[model samples]
Target: MSALETVRIREAGATLAAEAARFSGYGWMRGTSGNLSLVLDRDPLVLAVTASGLDKSELTDTDIVLIDGDGVSIDGDDPRPPSAEAGLHAHIAARTGAGAVFHVHAFDAVIAGHRWPGGIELRDMEMLKGIGHSAHDETVWIPVIENDQDMTVEADHFDRVYVPATAEVPEVPVLIVANHGMYAWGADAAEARRHLEIAEWLVRFTVATR
Candidate 1:
């Protein structure tokens, strides 16, 4: 299913929350350091996203909130809000039809971004094909954007810059947030989780074998 594949806000919200909750166990997104999202519908425009600053490890269904493309909360009576990077997830879903976007601050991904500061180049890895790339020779250019406090500005810049830069390579589903985390997207929440694992593996391998 594509990101545009619509579903009820409740279903979408629950799935995103569960995925975020599970990712916490990997010890990468430990202590609420990541966010998750899935597009709910396209007509009225909505997304189910993880609430901001919540501990992912012990998340509940209440932690999810439906938001518009601009990150406006639409559903859930909860007073808390979605993740700050929620806008970036919406921007990606709008552009890529990615059913889910999972982001986490894995040590290797973050360290690689800081060491490279521009991007991380992955090559000659057989698992590269898992993301649909045809050859190990294919280099995935993970955009490394400088982390910002203003999620709005960062989201705008992501669309204006990162999207355009990687438009020619849609198969690459992961992008690095400098000194922050890796943003991984896929056709659904399960796919997103798998890609996040693969992305983390790729970066970890790159760092280890360097």
Candidate 2:
């Protein structure tokens, strides 16, 4: 890779590390249970994924690995392997055109998924605006898919439930994996974090109410 590309990868790693730390502080990514990825290239689909088995709160800029569309490590120099969920991150990016994907094992996400196996529906809430919905009279459905250990199988399940945005329906940027956690994505790192936070908040509210 050229010097510029190398610099970009390093920058992406730092961004992921900081984001991971933020989530870890909330106990959502405790004990290396979550992963984050940033899309570096779109055509061939290259990503900078957080390295496997590292404490999210302690990661440095070097604690990341480059992976391809198939989650195969492309950075030979980096001894660390990509996170086990890297393939799922790649799949989400490919399907949604998202530039960043974040997975977190938030407790409320698990509870909400378990309570609403079909999906979680929230309407007419001011918080709904955070996920890009109208604050009034707009109903948002957060789909929940069954959790699977195999990344490929999980990706397939996500595909089955994903609905693209239309004039009548806005795009849902987050989804919960039943008995697992949640995945949120956006056009970039900051937006992805926002989506994840908002989704968690919504789920927490739902769980508390019902």
> Candidate 1: where are CA atoms >4 Å away?
1-7, 160-170
Q: Note the Cα lDDT for every prediction shown.
A: 0.77, 0.93
Candidate 2: which stretches are off by over 4 Å?
none
Q: Put down candidate 2 lDDT per residue, 1-210, tens digits, no spaces.
A: 899987998899999999999999999999888999999999999999999998999999888898999888997777888899899999999999999999999999999999999999998889888888888987889999999889999999999999988897779999999999999999999999999999899889989998
Worst 10 residues of 2 by lDDT: 74-83
Q: Per-residue lDDT tens digits of candidate 1, residues 1-210?
A: 344432365566667667766777777779878888877677766778888887888776657777888777875566787788887888788777888888888899999988887778877788777666645556676667888878777776566445432545655788888888899888888888888888888889888988
Identify the leading candidate in terms of TM-score. 2
Shift of residue 130 alpha carbon in model 1, Å: 1.6
Predicted model with the maximum lDDT: 2
lDDT of 2: 0.93
TM-score for all models, in order of appearance:
0.87, 0.97
Q: Give the TM-score of candidate 1.
A: 0.87
